[model samples]
Target: MAGVGLALRDGGDGGAPLFAAFAGAGAGLALAFSPTLTRAPATVRPEDAADASGLLATVTQLGRLIGVAAFGTLFLNRLESLGASGAYTSAEALLAGMDALALTAVAGAVSGLVRRRR
Candidate 1:
């Protein structure tokens, strides 16, 4: 779901409606997984389930915050660089940044799969 959203954002051609749909799809997918993923650790460690769940949620939020902050900074810097040369617009920079993040995510997914196989 997020993969699809990222793909759309990376090549959305500045379409607001398409981005909105992508966001909706991604949100739905995350909502579908939240319960199961959040509950699994609890099942394994009942005594500390509450703490574990809280930690999981905290880490998840932190990961999102960090990803956005880091990528946003990168996007702004790239935008500025391109603007200085009169070579690119804000939309282009946004797409470029999204593409960068999408590629990184793909790499991370591949590495995770490889590690699991080993």
Candidate 2:
């Protein structure tokens, strides 16, 4: 992740795309389970605590989704506008990493969800 940021700053050899995809996928998978994990009743049921925790988890998930979208968009836009030179373009590497994370996350989430259902 840190490498991605640096590469973006220094303009690497088109490695950012891979990083972004991984980041996006990770973000998606991590967030997708938010609701289910939140709503699940503990064997020992912590009552009010469990409910609060679930709410917190949901809120965090929302934030994660927002971040994922933002990063994904930034990466794609940067990639498309490779001809342009600016801070935005410089950010492409990090954004790419983030996108990759979120993309992976989404795929993992869908798979996990399906598996859980079965």
Candidate 3:
């Protein structure tokens, strides 16, 4: 009974909904960037098997935050260009887009590192 209580409070089934959302996002990103995030199922941590959905959820959420900060900064940077316009420009937008792509690549690298040893 004590164990059950611990499980419920410590991110057991109670956290299912949050994890589900994470997995949905993760699946989308994983599929979109399979070339980077792809790995053997066996490589995933044993704990991940219990909630493949949740682990993905957590990662996806954090990734989104990291991505937003990186890409947003790239887009909003004040710069002088376009004939001394000294204002927001398409160059920043383009850089932001590429930063997001690079972020995805880094996510894949993280997944590889987190992957369990066989």
Best by TM-score: 1
If the candidates were sorted by their lDDT against the true structure, best first, what order would they fall in? Answer: 1, 2, 3
lDDT of 3 by residue, 1-118 (tens): 1222222333235365546644555765566666434543346787776576566667868988987787566545522343267454554444445445556666766786787443
List candidate 2 stretches off by more than 4 Å.
Answer: 7-47, 83-118
lDDT of 1 by residue, 1-118 (tens): 3334444444445366666757765775476467657656856667887798787778878978998899899889988998999966676677677677767766866885797698
Clashes of each: 0, 29, 1
How high is the CA lDDT of each candidate model?
0.69, 0.62, 0.53
Superposed on all Cα atoms, model 1 deviates from the true structure by an RMSD in Å of 4.4
How much is 17 displaced in model 2, in angstroms?
A: 17
Tell me the TM-score of each prediction against the true structure: 0.68, 0.38, 0.39
Model 2 residue 28 distance off true place after TM-score fit, in angstroms:
19
Kindly report which residue stretches of model 3 are placed more than 4 angstroms away from their true locations once superposed.
1-48, 78-88, 96-118
The best-first sequence of candidates by TM-score reads: 1, 3, 2
Error of model 3, residue 71, in angstroms: 1.1
Candidate 1 accuracy as TM-score: 0.68
